[model samples]
Target: MNLNLYIMLKSSTIALLILLSGLFISCKQSKGLTVSNMKKHHIESNIKGLGDDTILVYYVPLSKMGEDYEPIQDTIFSKNDRFAYDTPSNEPILLYLFSKKGEFTRKSGHPYRPDEKHIVALVKPTDQLNITGELKQYYLDYQVQGSAFNEQYTQVRKNYIEATSEAVSIELKLDALMAINGDTTEINDLFQKRNAVNSAGRNAHLEYIKNNPDKDLAAYYLTRQPWEIFGKYYNELSLNVRNGIFKNALESKIIKYKKYTQVQEAELKIKEGESAPDFELRSLSGNFSLNAVKTKYIVLDFWGSWCPPCTKGFPKMKAYYSKYKESIEFIGIDCNETEEKWRKAVLNYDLPWPQVINKLDIDDDVSVKYGIKAYPTKFIIDKDKKILAKFIGKDDSFYQKLDELMATK
Candidate 1:
């Protein structure tokens, strides 16, 4: 009676591929044409089976798209909460799938619209796809049910004077204890502890499910929990963790967190006009010099073997380098890359730039030194070895700046 097997079977990668591929092809059919110049498009999932048990997500990045696509009405979606959508218009129908991950789409349905100059994703649960739609049913038996139960639980806990408040209070207390502590020696130490606590909590939760194999909590915990946790706190938590380095330390161990911080420190050092600190890194090819790439204008690019965005940008860089070889020199600084993957990426990417790897076994020193808070941070330097400008992200604005600066020189 282990429902986990069914859940696993339903949530297989193959199923997602099929569903996504279907969506991709559907978007490409030129015959079913709908043309529009409207400010925003209304989107909803035509989910059929689960009458009232579906979660929907919609995303809009204001910075990218501007203020054109604001919802005309309020857009909350969960069904069973004190603060549940009051007016019918308040229900969020635009479920944004783009915020979480990338999906294949026809070139015509590219996420960015040409004239709009914005990126937005509208997503919602659909009965058409059995997995994302019935997520609620999988959590019905757990003490912590789906978003609905969570919403109800929150209200129940908040209304201490009301009935069932005591039970809700207990659950909240248990969650607080099991969750990672936020205070610790260093941010690094805190993250480690938090991860350990999270691991322990998952194990305990799994054991509970094993004993209650018929229950859906197992599926909820394994499949839907990541979405719930991540969806609820993705943006805020990301910003906080990023800004948190200065605020306070985490109570758990986070290896990734430490790596990011180290990279940040190095970036700051280089930004403050410190000498481009020298570090030797081992690559698949051989040891190479980080400082050796110094030229009239060095373009130090941070990338990894696994990143898709890196692959897309490398070609453009190669083309740019070829056009301006005498005026500029480019250096590829590999980050968190395995030797095999590094070599393959270089060959596949057809990167014409001088490439080097960090052999110091350092945690991505190039990224750290250049204040490369993210991938594809490019810095323009004058012949005097001073930084001209730092491009934050790999976008058109970045290239525009490069062209402008190169022209000025």
Candidate 2:
């Protein structure tokens, strides 16, 4: 019998998720089950129905979860989703039920009360589930196909292991080339597929070689791609980037692939030693500029309201601002988030700094001037407009750096 490739692929992904979840949960246990025992303990019984797309799997929960477990049905349980009761309470096993909605519609008898421990699931014999044997054959066929495809994928990636090793080499070569020549423009052009024509051209060259590697035409066409032109194709391109060496060559052709992205507009460009760029920025409070706070050291914080880390970092920033308001200032440039979310996070986090919005992206000329790339990039500027330090992420070193900068000259 035959089955849809999409369903087969989706089931395969679910299986992989289950394996990963099991591994993650098991890591916390001191006496984890052996791999052979794990396979034996896990029961997976497949049932195919009149609706050929859905597969009904009946199995007891893992070693940690008991059979009397009541799975969370509304918020947690879905037919196709995995669930684990035997594992840690925090780590629920995946219980994938084949359903059209891809979600379980059943509500828990308890209704939002997550503390309940015991529940029961009904799994009848394959001949008793009211499904024909023909449909079951499709399930069997799909399982075989799925397994074969997975094995092939694993082998293909393994075959390209040496080629993948070339990625680091490409990075090193690019670094050397950049060191020798101040201009990165030519190298940048190969990676940038800003236009549709360029994108289509790049993909076509990659696909042709990938599907037809034996032909001289494919080789010639692949050599014409950008990565090949730079003589770094073998070492630079990723497997997902396509066509092995040829794809790597094309990838190297794309421009600014490794360039830093600006997360906000209205960002200042002045370097640590250079005079800070002058700007008039507007906020709900009113327009303000750096000149107004010339005597105070300032921290330029770039973030988005939607960013969770950005939200978490705000309280620490608030504490620092509260401690140094008399001698230091904070100018926040909110980027790539909605006005509502931004305002909400500010109010929620109780941010004390002078906040402003930059509608333009961080990569714009204004952001480029400051060399801003990632979110929550904090820069400490002295009263004389010299950059003292740059901090990324919430780490012990970041706090230490901040304290050292704030300690005084």
Candidate 3:
């Protein structure tokens, strides 16, 4: 089974949707919702075989909420197999229940483990939820009482677990067998079986959305699906659901999907060895003319203060800058950040390089000229203004590629 299918079904679109404001911390006087000034909703869970571990709680971010799209994250230690959590949600939304042992990815903000012990509940602001079940048999025999949407999604979730269980089992078996060079014929047969099972599961989940468009829970199901799947049955959902809690998030997804389509269509807009796009970027000191820089090479770092991976990669970036400061011109292009933050970041990081700031959103018109789709993008250009390489993420690959170029000298 493809790992992405699980991501789609469970809807990890969360980590991706969080291209928004920084996360807000709602400090609690205690786990029992003691904050009088802040909006707090509570959830309690009592389970067998979970007393030894903690529960990680995460609520889905609402893109429609404007500045409040960052979800509240918390880790609660269970006392005697029972624990409670305080979440913030003014409307009905999805909340994830992850066992600490599940190793949920914080950066991605979702569970990558397909068979991880977890629960997905539809939480409403006014309702108090109680989850009672054996952790091991959660999908088969769990009870989420006191919320209609929670009850509705739990029903859908059970069958989904059943549909994908066999595939997950086979996937684990394949993992073990592949580790020791097990039977080739057996591996091939298992691969086919898993794919078949996953395809059926995917179809069934989609069919439920198609057949029962009136249920708001079905809209929740649609939320878990990727845009390719959601676009198919969006009109089928009830008008209330179409314009309800999911409205803002759904609209955001649609706009992003359209932009992604545009980026895909304009694949040739930026590439290595091509003439660098004609553009002007200003710095605090003076006009930072691109053509005027006559260094052996130019390393253009397109970054933003809001991006974690971008700023986190600066240590290694500075090391490279220090090594090649005399031979190469290093420039940092700050995008989608306020000028104040950009200037502060330059001073805070103590970066000895030219810095240019773009105080606009990622979708601002300026980004289109360079064909940038994501943050922390970089371009290495030769003295002749031809792009040598382009990198998207802040990773060792960019530095490794730089090393290959410098080795010739």
Candidate 4:
């Protein structure tokens, strides 16, 4: 009778043990699901010496221009010299950080002078990046940690900077010389020396790309460097890196480079002594044709409303138009902008020249026809519709060329 009772108790104990085991397994699975569902990707930073300055974070793409040119910015105020950004993606991206005060200074100053108080960081989701440095050495003398790619980027950037420091110094001297109209021989010598340093830096970048084919930093440099120089490296990169966040951008660059090569081959058709490609576009005055404008000379200025350089160059264009209106025709072709923006820019700048709009999104037919790659590209055509000179950006040389051409009968 005692043995039977003991067996019954043992069976009951085994049943209870099995029930507890099932409950334990269920609870573990539930906890795992909860953890998996939680938000995981974030960018946290502790930037020292920034005080309470307003930090603006921007997602700057590789192309740096286009309809996507509008940066995705977050206005975060620094409290206790710290800020953070959270996103759902863990993919690496180019992030630019700037103080609101510095941004204002950048906008107000010469457009070409880069903001010295800004820093460019390679950040990704779930990265806890820490930047430590004084405000005076915002970009330089800073320490970054927490992401492998960012650390690699920082090292590469430091190497590049060190390699190009001599060239930068030479460039600064050259700028000063040019500002004061120094001797041509000295200026030319400085320019050549600077170019040689730049070449060395470029070679260093190539070697870096070769050594780190799998790194996203390589892909970034592939996009930033000239196609003729870095295109081969891009092909050598692993498929995984190539097809990452910058895949579409890299592909677009390849396409544009191919188009640019084609344009170079066909540039003879629009070079000096060759006839200009004729086209018609809608203007504020109404539909206008290039052939219809009869004058001793014509200035075809291809620009866009969103382009900062174009806006800066308009005042000079206006002055030139005022001086040469009697002897030459000035026409502005606005590209890749909405009608509203185009009109507003034209009116805001008081552009007296006949203005036309290119409705195409990218690589407008008119720009492609003339092999125009960048703005504000200007073409000087004679009465016989022959291309005399082509200018990429407005400068003293552009006006000098115009003067020389206008002087000709």
Candidate 5:
């Protein structure tokens, strides 16, 4: 049902918030429900003037692996103007609701319709939640009651939606302006307004956290806040609250936060002009080491086959590699990809330079050593193994820097 387009229009705000929240939650395999561990919850949904529509319940795990993994889903048919379902979990989990038949096109008659058929809310064990809304309004006009956490979540989410609406509007206007080569003055004003709105959202989030320190909703919100703010207030929660079922996810976040801190500290020591960290990883041909490469300069490209931006940027990188093959080496460090997809991407892109796979996991030892944060992160190193520059994503400036370095020799 064109889920991509559906999500783009309907869930842009939620997606943006999730992106800004950074990586904190990790989903773990659920333990099989047993008498000792089972906690069941009930959800009764009433959609006015609906008949014979299929309702879907999806359980989304809050783990790193679960982020890309398919959610556990169940289906129920609406009858007598209401639909109900039961969820069993060992702890609190996130759930998403969708109507199989609801789809609405935008006012502009965009070919793809937004999946206005759905809403998401938090649920805990033993909670009985009631949801009431019209099929037409869906998420925007829905009302949820009976679960305190869900109620608080709705409140916090409203503030976030309001705070980001102006920024999102400005961004859309900027996109239209750029499409038509509109006035630079208008573009700059939009940019300023966007940043101001984002700053206001962050401030509002911080205030919400301070006022609701003991609530699980606060812990959930904490996971989405920036690391700097998270570090400031994470320790303030009491032990009992921290150890609660809903808040247990924060434990893993704490561990990752510590690792992120260590990586940041390590990056300071290996900044530009410092010697690059040496590591050995297996390539398709043989074992390759950073110190053994025979070149005056090296470009370490950390990426994954699944990342669209990584693949999109490859043509430019390939062009650069062809131009600099004699004097510079380009090494593609494929991270968080299956072996088959990795090989396919290398062949698909016709990457001529040396390539290697992280082969272990997303956050491998080599990536940690270099403080790699995002995909398609490139580090340019000189003959002495000193880092010349580090850049993320593809741009003319990246090529310009490489050209300047190449011109030196």
Candidate 6:
């Protein structure tokens, strides 16, 4: 019941690979991909032991992905261990699967981690992905038949799953040992061996991509690699592969890493204590301009709904806004997400402050202008747009500073 939260930007090699296998397939929305115009694809599964269960389906509109993203959700029910569904896709798109309200048992008292409770597919037009396996083996071991990408992903995932199997077994044993007050001396040695085994598996997956630069699987793996590795092979990819369905996703990752041929193009540099750089976003009222906002004091909250810490501070932030609404102006600059997600978060949080989205595609994105690297980054500016102070996280320090500054007000 205590499901681990899905991490959007974890840096683990296998985690990145899973994210790529399921979420990194993307395209540009401006290219005009509509449901009516798209081709439908088939997906069916027959896994033993999964009776009368539902597989939760999720996919990000490949066209409109951002650093902070959410997958659109749908579900398919399986009765008697079989199910099928159809989805529209003009090009390759990632689909993720999991059983709702289910945690497949492992050994003794530990269950398989929720993070590992997943099956992924690279769905394409006219494609039929058939998943067949024993549910107890976990989804990664599922036999996904239909495409070369599936073949490649399954092969690499085997190594990861094997390592995780051992890791999970060790974890359960460690828990049992700790519960009975058993000797924990061997536990350190076991952890060291676990790390060694996992490291070997991670290296194996990394090498698979490194050797197969021309494969589409390589594109996904390369996204997680550093520039030296990513840059070297990204160019080595075939022309079709380079400009394939993952073009936007790869390009977005490039921009995030701030490397490759886009260095000078992404050149927007500024620091605190300097005059805050001006930016603009269209609001329901009209264009909201940073320079045009006339206020004695402004609280610029740069955040995203996907970020737990960012959303966690909403109640306190709302309370502060209520107290200071008469004199201080508060602005919410939603970063690294689709506009739909931004709007949903606005309503969900009932953020009482004026909200606008940051232009992630543009060079002068507010996050870049102010050099913000963390979520819930705060900047307080005076009426003249002079940077008064800055805070990197959600803490009482920002409120403390605000109280100190507003003591006279």
Which pairs of residues collide in candidate 5? 26-62, 26-63, 26-64, 27-62, 27-63
* Local accuracy by lDDT, each model: 0.40, 0.42, 0.65, 0.63, 0.65, 0.67
Error of 1 at 229 (Å): 15
For model 6, the stretches where C-alpha displacement exceeds 4 angstroms are 1-48, 57-95, 99-115, 123-132, 137-140, 165-202, 223-233, 252-272, 281-295, 304-308, 318-329, 336-357, 382-386, 407-409
Q: Against the hidden reference, what TM-scores do the models get?
A: 0.41, 0.41, 0.64, 0.65, 0.72, 0.64
Kindly list the per-residue Cα lDDT of model 6 for residues 286-329, writing each as its tens digit.
Answer: 67888887866888998888788788889999999998887788
**Model 5 collision count:** 5
* Residues 60-100, model 5: lDDT tens digits: 55542113344565666677556766676655567776664
Question: How many clashing pairs in candidate 6?
Answer: 2
Please report the candidate that would top TM-score against the real structure: 5
Candidate of highest lDDT: 6
C-alpha displacement of 98 in model 6, angstroms?
Answer: 3.6
| Cα shift from native, residue 242, model 4 (Å) | 2.3
lDDT of 3: 0.65
Error of 4 at 24 (Å): 54
Writing each residue's lDDT as its tens digit, candidate 1 over 101-188 gives 2221223443221101111122223211111221121111111123342333222222322222222233333334334542334434
The TM-score that candidate 2 achieves is 0.41
Looking at model 6, residue 360 earns an lDDT score of 58
The sequence of per-residue lDDT tens digits that candidate 2 reaches over residues 176-236 is 5555663567446422422322344345556655664454334334434443332433233
| Per-residue lDDT of candidate 4, residues 1-409 (tens digit) | 1110111111211332233222221111111111112443244445567666666555545344211344454555666665555533346556766654332112223222122345667766556666655454223334567777667766665665545556545755766776777898999899888778767656766787889888777776676576565556768888998887667667766765665566566665678888988888899979988899775689898888666677788778888999999888888998766889899988998888899987463344587688766667788898999988887764567799888866876
